[model samples]
Target: MGIMKDFKSFAMRGNVVDLAVAVVIGGAFGKIIASFVNDVLMPPIGLLLGGADFSNLKVVLKAGSEAILNGDAVVTPAVAEVAIKYGSFVNTVVDFTIVAFAIFMVIKAIEKTKKKEAAKPAAPPAPSKEEVLLSEIRDILKEKQ
Candidate 1:
């Protein structure tokens, strides 16, 4: 029961909830960025690169063998193609760069706003009635002296 209460308290913490929400939103944002990169951005870039498809780009390391049965090509087994897909990696890198830059810009704008707010002079607070009475008393005492 104590452990359960502790778990509940931990789960209900503001930071924990905020982090969970951030994780969910971040996942969605990543998906949107990936779609933008793969669907929207990559198509034009691929065209500019002489119709090169990044996803299909790879370096074949091992070419799988085709089996020949009974001196005739009866059934060929599936060939395991080992390759490094750098084009997809490049796309992912671009996505990461864009996301990072966007986050940086957001943070920068927030910091700039904060600085502007801090730089503005705040109005002085009004003095209390007790402070006004004390000043009057002090002035009377000074006159008597």
Candidate 2:
């Protein structure tokens, strides 16, 4: 029960909740970026590159083999193809770059806002009526002395 209560309190903390929200939003943002890269950005780039598809680009390291089965006897097993998928890596790198730039811009904007707020001078507080009266009395006392 105590552990449950502790967990509830921890989960309900402002920073923890904010982090969870950030994680969810970040995931959505990543998906949007991925869609943008794959659907929108890649097509134009591919067209510019003479209609080359990045996803399909790979270096076949080893050729795949088909399995041969005859009369419930397997002669050879099916082997999967091994390749270096550099095109997908490129797409991922681009996605990461865009996300990093976006986050950097957001942080920069936030910092700029904070700096602006901090740069403005705060207005001085007004003295209370009692303080004013006390000052006047003190002045009178000083003049008498």
Candidate 3:
């Protein structure tokens, strides 16, 4: 029970909770970026590059063959094509670039706000006791005059 309570406390800490929220939001943001890269960005780029589909782009390392059979009895199973899918890699790189740029912009904006806050002049400090006493004595002398 003590261990459970400790675990709960650790998990419910502000930093821990904030980290969890960040992970969830980061996952969703990644999906949105991937969709933008795959659906919106790639199509126009593909069209410009002579209708080449990036996802389907690959270099066949070994040519695959159909199942070998004798009298409809399979002697060998169907072999799958093995290839380097570089188009998917390209899309992934683009997604990473966009995400990095977005995080950079967010950091820049945060820093800008921090600088603005720091640049504002602080409120002047309250007068010391001696200054207050001095001012009161000066006012008393003025009254006498």
lDDT (10s digit) by residue, model 1, range 1-90: 999999999999999999999999999999999999999999999999999988788888997776656566567666777888899899
Q: Worst ten-residue run, lDDT, model 1?
A: 68-77
Candidate that scores best on lDDT: 3
For residues 1-145, what per-residue lDDT tens digits would candidate 2 score against the true structure?
Answer: 9999999999999999999999999999999999999999998999999998898889999999989999799989899999999999989998999999999999999999999999999998899999999999999999999
Scored by TM-score, the top model is 3
**Number of clashes in model 3?**
0
Candidate 3 regions off by >4 Å? 66-73, 128-134
Weakest 10 consecutive residues of candidate 3 by summed lDDT:
63-72
RMSD of each: 3.9, 3.5, 2.1
Model 3: per-residue lDDT, tens digit, 1-145?
9999999999999999999999999999999999999999999999999999999999999888899999989998989999999999999999999999999999999999999999999999999999999999999999999
Q: Which ranking of candidates, highest TM-score first?
A: 3, 2, 1
What lDDT would each prediction earn against the true structure? Answer: 0.91, 0.95, 0.97
Query: How many residue pairs clash (N, CA or C atoms closer than 3 angstroms) in each of the candidate models, in the order given?
Result: 0, 0, 0
Ranked by lDDT, the better of candidates 1 and 2 is: 2
